[model samples]
Target: MTDAFVAALPKAELHVHLEGTLEPEMLFALAARNHVELPWPDVEQARAAYTFTGLEHFLPLLFRAASVLRTRQDFYDLARSYLTRAAADGVRRAEMFLGVQTFLDAGTPIGDQLDAVLAAISDARTDLGIDGALIVTSQRHRTQAAALEVLELIEPWRDRLLGIGLGAAERGNPPAKFADYYATARARGYRTTIHAGEDGPPEYVREALDICRADRIDHGVAASADPDLMARLGDEAVPLTVCPLSNVALRVVPSMAAHPLPAMMAAGLLVTVNSDDPPYLGGYVNDNYQAVHTDLGLDRPALADLARNSFRASFDDPHRIAAHLAAVDAHVRANQPPERAYRAASAAR
Candidate 1:
C-alpha cells in the first residue's frame, strides 16, 4: 500500500537538509575523492552508526557525514544525488537546508561550497527537470553574531539563495536570540523559516512566528500541545513541516501512533509531511508519507490534502503552485483508495 501510494503522488519538500542527504555510499566516495580521512572503517560501518538517541547524539553523526564535503564539486554532487532520488520519489520541487557554518568552521572555502551547490541546483532544474532552491541555515548552537555573519556572507548571492534559516540544537538556542538576524533577512527581502518546537517547548514555536517572523515553521508538531498557539496557527494558516520518521528516529515522539499529525490536521493547522535527514533516518519523503498513512489511518483524500499543503507551502511561484496543486488533485482523482492499494500490496507480498 505504502509503495503504490507514493509511486503516483507528487509533492514539494520543505524541510530536507542537503547536507543530510549524504548517503553512506556517497560519504565514503567523497572522503576518498577529496583525500580526507573518515573515522568509520567502511561504508557499512558508517551506515550502522546512524543510531541516534537524541539531537545531541545525532548531530555528531551529521557533522561526520558532512566532513567529506570539502569541495564545490562535492557539494554539487551531493545536491545532484539528492534531487535525482527525490525526483524518483515524485518530488517536483525541493527547498533544501544547508548549514554553511559547518563548512566554514572546517576551513573550506565557502564559495567553493556555495558555488557548487547553487550550480547543482541549476543543473537539476535543466537536467532532471526538478526545481530546487537553497536556504542558508545558521547553526543555532552558534552565536547570533555568527548568524549575522552568515547573512552578510550570503548577501552577495541574494538572488540565488532563497532565504535565511535557523537549525541545529534547539534546547538552549531559543528563536528570540536571533531576532535581529531574522529582521535583517526580512529587511533584505528574503523569506525565513526556523527550527522550532521540534525538541523545544511550544513557546519556541510562538517566538519563531512572532519574534523571528518565520515565513514558515519547521517541525512545529509541538504547537499542538498549546491550544492558544494551535488556534493562532490555524487562524493564521501557518504551515508546519512535520517529519514523522525523523521524530521517531530522534525519539521526539514515543512512536508514530503518538505523533500528533492527525490531531494537528483536525485542529485546522496546515501540515505537510517531509523526510528530514532521510538517509540517516532510514526513509525518504515517500517513506514518511507511507508511515503516516498506515500509522495514522489516513486515506487517499487525507493523503491528497497533505500533498496539496506541500505545494501550497512551497516557495514556488504562485502560478507554479497552482499548477502543482492541480496535478495533485488530478492524481488523487485517478488513483484507487489506499485500502485497496494496501490489499494489492499484501497479495503481491
Candidate 2:
C-alpha cells in the first residue's frame, strides 16, 4: 500500500504498555503535578536517558516514570493521552498492557489504579471512538504468588480486562517460573500471552507455549533460531506480537534493518507488528509499520496481512474484531491497483 493508504487503514494494536507510553513531556508534567521530583532536569535529558543496554537497564527509568503517577487522575490522564494518540493513528482497537507491580510497590491500591485506568479507557472510547481494553501485566522478576495476587485484584474487572500478561525482565525468569499463575488465569477463563524470545532465548518461547499455556507470544524473535520452534509456531498459527523498534532500542537486535520480522514472516510464522513501548522506543504503531516497511522492504500485501493479523491476534470481542477486519479489508480493496492497470504498468516497465 502507498504511505497514505497504509496510514488510513484501520488497525488494532495488541502489545502496547500504558506506562511506557509516558512521553517525556507528560512525565515532567505529571511529576510536577504530584509534587514528585524527576531525575532528569529537562525533556531532552529524559529523552537521552531512554537509551538502554537491556530491559533491566530500562526498568529503573520505567519505574521512575511510574513513580510520578500517584493518583487516580494521573492514571486517567495517562490512558486518555495514549488512546487519543492511538485513535489519531487509525487504531480502531487496542489491548493496552499496564504494569501494576510498580504502582503496588509505591503503595497505591491496585483497585484504585484499575478503576482509574478503566475509567479513562471508557471515557476515551466514548469521546474518541477508540475501542480498547486493559491487560494487567505481572513482572517476571516477581514471584508467581505476586502475579496471582494481581490476578485476584483484576478478578472484579475481568469483564473489562482482556487478560493477564507476563512482562518486565524476561531473561532468567522463564515462562515456566509463572506456570501456575498462567494456569490459574487460564482456569479462571482469562486469555493469556507472555513476553518471550526478545531478551530470552528460543527455549523461553517453548516454555511460554508448553508451561505457561500462552495464547500468543510477545516478541518471539528468537524463535527463528530454532527450526523446531518455528515449525511448531507455524503449525499452531500462534501470533507473535513483534516490536521492531523496541528490539532495536533495547539492544536485543543491533538495528531496525536487521530485525527478525522479515525472517519470521518468510518462515510462515504468524507475525504482527506493534509499538511495545512507543515513547521510549521513539515511535508509535504507524512509525513502527513505516520502519519495518522501509527497512525490511515489506510489500503492500504483506503489510496488509500484518494489519489483519493485528486484529486477529487481539483479544477484542468477536463482533468488534469482525468490524475492524472488515474495515481493513475494505481499505485494502479500495486502495488496491486494478489488475489490468498493474499489467500495463509492468509491461511499460
| TM-score, one value per model | 0.95, 0.95
Looking at candidate 1, what is the lDDT of residue 154?
Answer: 82
Tens-digit per-residue lDDT, 292-329, candidate 2: 88888887788888998998888777898888888988
Error of 1 at 299 (Å): 1.0
Q: Which stretches of candidate 1 lie over 4 Å from their true place?
A: 337-349
Please give the distance, in angstroms, between residue 234's alpha carbon in candidate 1 and its true position after superposition: 0.6
Q: In model 2, where do residues sit more than 4 Å from their true spots?
A: 337-349
Q: Whole-model lDDT for model 1 versus the true structure?
A: 0.90
Cα deviation of 213 in candidate 2 (Å)?
0.6
RMSD vs true structure, all candidates = 4.5, 3.0
In terms of TM-score, how similar is model 2 to the real structure? Answer: 0.95
Compared with the true structure, model 1 gives a TM-score of 0.95
**How do the residues 1-349 of candidate 1 rate in per-residue lDDT, one tens digit apiece?**
4567676698999999999989999999998998889989998988889887988899988997798898878888999999999888889989999999999988877788789989988998998888999999999999999999988888878988888789999998899999999999999989999999999999999999889989999999888889999999999999889999999999999899999999998988889999999999858999999998888888778888999999989877999999999999778655867796687668889
Displacement of residue 56 (Cα, Å) in model 2 is 1.5
